[model samples]
Target: MVEVNQFYLKFEANPDRYTLSDLNFCLNHGESLLLLGPSGCGKSTLTYCLNGLYPRELDGEMRGEIVINGKPATEYRPGEISQQVGVVFQDPETQFCMLTVEDEVAFGLENIGVPHEIMEGKINHVLEMVQLLAFKKSAISSLSGGQKQRLALACILALEPSLLILDEPTANLDPIAKKDVIHTIQSIQEKTNCSLIIIEHQLDGWTELTERCLLLNRKGIIFYDGDIRDAIAFKLDELQEQGIWLPKITQYLLKKRLKTEQKLPLTVKEFEEKPFSLFGNEEVNEGNNLPEAGLPYIKASHISWKVGQQPIIQDISLTLYNGEFIAIVGANGSGKTSFSRILAGIQRPTKGSVSIKDRKLGSWKESQLREEVGYVFQNPEHQFIANTVFDEIAFSLRLKMENEAVVKEKVQAVLETCGLLQLQHEHPYALSQGQKRRLSVAAMIVDDQPFLLLDEPTFGQDASSNAELMGLLQGRYESGATIAMITHDMELIHDFATRVIVLHKGRLVADLAPTELWQLPIEKLHKWQLALPIQVQVQNCLKKEGDYAAQSS
Candidate 1:
């Protein structure tokens, strides 16, 4: 249904540098292809070319041929092409154009000139397919990130395009929400005969659904194009170095030096169905070695925040000790970000109060507060205040009136640590998603504040960068920094957080150690729209099988 031949592309400003070159691929009707590569490798750029958003909207030079449904893609107008190819972008908020869920889903249908009668049915059907029927009348502003993502998919599905493209659809979602989106996509594929092209970093839930995989190199060249299983099993190390994610099961096999000749598991269920000698033999000590309770460095007492008539956070009380890694997690709109803002003095609470080191947060001067606590917003762009990456990181040091030699040394160290040295002179907005995240962190941590707070720190990061960034954060924490992070990555919470705080409906629901939190009922966790990490899920599955075997014996 889709074909590309000897494709080459270079942006207008950089004529000598080809962002994408010699790209070639074809997809038949009802087939699914997974696109995998590191950040800034032209994965999203390729999607733009395929969706007709490249040459027309984004100024760029292009070559070769791209045909959709036996017709040259270049021949069709953007409006006409929308009927054949539908895309659900990575950021759902950017795709919204209407106030209500029903209107947003129907907007695309109306644009295509569908009859009012059929549009009603199409809108309702797609909304139901995505399990958003109950929210059909709700305002888009009130929906959670996960709900917004479903709404985006509903809009695309209503058009019933022959080819569906999803780029990093699960990047910003929690695990349970991620699963919900994954299931909706699978259901759509089963019901409709459409080709699928997914550009994603999360590989857990996509293995079984994808038939083929296309791996792109750093230069945007197609490195591997073949069966999904073969691409993963044979090219595991290569993919890992490319910053692409591998399934946990595959990673385990690789670590154990086990050969995947005739047997390779894609999903956890597949791995469980097959017996392995290595199962249930190792003692995995699961515990967070938190220090004894000390004097509270920061405290929040009965804090509440409301917007007009709606209360977002209510009566939340907590104490954060010095030199501890705390993870604040919850479902979308559960007030995680609101609470973080309150802690950082960005948003004042409607009731109650917060204090830093026995001093009321409000009493601290802006300059003093900034020096004592460093904050990285969920959207990195919000915190950026300089033209170039170099200046952004050096801004803090320069404000302190440090000597040129000292400022240069500190800024360069942070740049190298966060892998932004090469991008020092580049504009912050021009960098890739991963690069932006690194720059944001580099800028905030340059001053080495005593307390650091980050919202969704690993949102757009790839594997290698994630490890590198987290390692840097760990070093900072060890150097007597008190860290609090609002994240949806359960793996990060499990591995790093000394204490896990769960919020639900604007209240502190649970505050416990990572191991203790996991021991709670799965249904209870689901109530907050949370999920276990892949490693924890695997352990639970193995434990259940062992219990059954022992009972039978």
Candidate 2:
């Protein structure tokens, strides 16, 4: 068990004010605690506090105290903390310090000097628990977003701590992997009866597993605490008003204001079994061709790309019209990223050609190609090559050796559009994850390209940041920009995508609209390792069973 007494945490970045202020929490054995909050709410910082990173590794000021199993957490060495409390960070990629999956999984155990003789069994057990046994020797760099997450969980479980704290363990994973990881983590918690604390924004995925929920506001004080299901159902409106993500199915019922059942479902499976009077056809027309508009702005013909003797993309043919927003989804290593790079002309296909406005891509000058197509990478930090936000955004404009006045005006204009105007002087590296994503994105958008290819644009962003990015993209689409995104966030496709493309084993499987996608067999989506959002699934189910028609009758 762990207890925090009137905890106050501050940092040198702000000479005053605790990131988490006057907060008190108590966690007991065999109970799972969910920490929910908006972006920059200090939920993650609070986790660091309980695990002794607050005043130590993070170099911050700490008041009050945290006691774990009747001992001060502050007194423990990091290694000691690792034994008592295992932590899986928000970004699985950043936490990996090893070259291979096996090495990373065994890292903490080896650090604590868990004997080599006893290491194999522990490693195998956790890998099996997290369903990463087959990938034991895989390189960390080659893993899919989901595989990387599973490995992170395996690494912490190998430590076998008395408590497990996961910081958004599924943020980068696809929905299937997210659900699998969530299920596996809950099983481990129930079987071992270890104290569990999970900090996550995707609420619905964890509903079936959560026991106690703690809602932390931006100020870091607990706004609500009690039974997970009851609290969510009780304060559903308030949580939604704060722009927080509730379970998808719950939100569906809440929209209708249906007050039936003691508790609304927090997941797809639970909702499918419950009876309802509302037709699934609340807003969509039946049997109509997905909206059609305009002509192709960019087209590819028989494109085949290769690296050495291996084909990264095979016989890809596609068309992107003006002002269209498309999501390209596939499992990691399925060539979605490679395909994006090709579309942006960042990678050349060995065979065939890409046409932009009836001209071959190879015919365009480098400057002309860049002016027409902009590619944003998955790692935002890597894209930043400048000192400050202003310089980063201004770097390309300056590269043209434009006049100083022109450069300043263009940079300032983009800064305002990307919401980084206030942080113009701040080091790009020093900004928060959300800010860094926006800054990097701003650089690409400032050029005002007609076509954009983005790789995992929303992977690590907070809800607010993701929404802001979506709105910006939507505005651009309305103003005649063709946008293609490679991503793992399925909800993003369900809500914002005008078209969905699924790739499997380096081949295009399906390309259709969101409404049309719901009509396809669910198994096909799963076979491609794609996950449909819960509402889409529920809607599909209701339609198939004539539940909607019955309601109308």
Candidate 3:
């Protein structure tokens, strides 16, 4: 279905640098391939090449050979390759052209020249496959992040391409939504027998679907390509070093170091089959020792925000103390971003009040508020204003009339911290999605505001980059900075967040310690679309096993 031989790609902006170097791989019909790599490792670039968006649409130079469906890439007419190889991008919003779900699918079929008489049937069939049949008449703007992604898949599947490429399809989805999209993809693959190339960093739900793995190093060269089990069992260390995310069960095994010769399990069910003791003598401390309550940093009382008649945030009251690490979590469109923006003073509430350190949010001058609070948008590009990466970070410092030498020192320090020093001269827009997210964060953290509010700061990050960014944020929190982040990653909540805030239907439902959040009823967690962290799950499993053994004895 697909083949690449000694492929190399270089962009016009960086003629001397190769984005992807000497990549060689092939995919047989009905085979599913998982492409794993670190941030900015040319994973997305390679996908573009396979989908015929490289030299033809994007400004890049391509060398060597790329064959799709028995034809060389260069020989295909404009937009012809798309009929054979369809790509669903990371952001589904970029792929939609129509307003409603049905119309969106029809647009793709119309472009592909499907018969008008069968277009409705095709649209309904694909929508039903993705479980979006009920939403056929719904507006695209009305769908949740997960629904939009499924609709995107439906559009592509309507084309009936032989090879389907999904680029981080669930990266931005909530836990339940992520599972839904993965299940939808699996169903499609089973029914269509189409080849797949999935590029993603989150591997928990995907490893089970793919048979082979293609690992790429930071230098854009293939590091390992073989059976998925062999790569995880034998090359675990190398995969970790490259910042690839291992399956949750594998991660637990690596950390616990259980004495076993059996192959590493990929899923929790598989792990449960093995006789292993996770807890022996040591008592599990699920709770964290939270910091003492300090002075109130930001206070919101009965905060309610709405768009026209639609309520987004409803009667939410909370206080962010000094030096608190709080994570806001909920389902997509549950008003996490809306509430965060209200706290950051980016958006005014329709009712009630917000105060920062005693002053009402509305009373603070624009300049004073900017100094007191730093807000990072979910979309990194929304916050960028400078041309170069260095200038972006330095923009905040220079506004305060700092000395050039001092500005350079602070900017360089932050650039290095976020792993963007090497790309300082590059335009901010030219950076990869992960790099752009880091740059947005670096620009805000350089100044060290007292209160920092981030919306999905680690959305597009790889393992290593995520660690670096979180580490930097941790340091800031330790230095008396109040932090609140809107995130979908339960692992981040487990590891860093001192407090977890839950929202449902625009209302604050639960606010508690991370451990307490994990202790909620399993059904309630599922209703909220929340998943327990792997660590917590393992500990719970061990507790259940111990209880059963004691009863039997």
Q: Write the per-residue lDDT of candidate 3 for residues 184-278, one digit (tens) a residue.
A: 88888898899999999888889779858899988899989998789877887888898888887677677766655667788887766767553
> Which is the winner by lDDT between candidate 2 and candidate 3?
3
Better of 1 and 2 by TM-score: 1
Residue pairs clashing in model 3 are none
Per-residue lDDT for 273 in model 3? 71
Pairs of residues clashing in candidate 2: none
Per-residue C-alpha lDDT of model 2 across residues 481-525, encoded as one tens digit per residue: 888888777667776778888887778888888777766787877
Model 1, runs deviating above 4 Å: 117-121, 131-143, 256-262, 278-280, 287-289, 548-553
How much lDDT does each candidate structure score?
0.85, 0.77, 0.86
- Which is the winner by TM-score between candidate 1 and candidate 3? 3
In terms of lDDT, which candidate is stronger, 1 or 3? 3
What lDDT, from 0 to 1, does candidate 3 have?
Answer: 0.86
TM-score of each: 0.94, 0.88, 0.95
lDDT of 1 by residue, 1-553 (tens): 9999999999865678898999999999999999988877888888888888877876668999999999988999768888889998867787888999999988888887899977888888888877789889888987766678778888998888899999888776777777888888888888888999998876878887885899997788998999868887678678888888777666655655655456577788887787644453444446575667766899999999987777899999999999889999998778888899999988999999999999999799999999999999876888888999999999999999999999999999988888888779888987777788899999999998999999988877778888898999899998889999989888788778999899999999999888888888999999998887666776777777788878999
Sort by lDDT, best first. Answer: 3, 1, 2
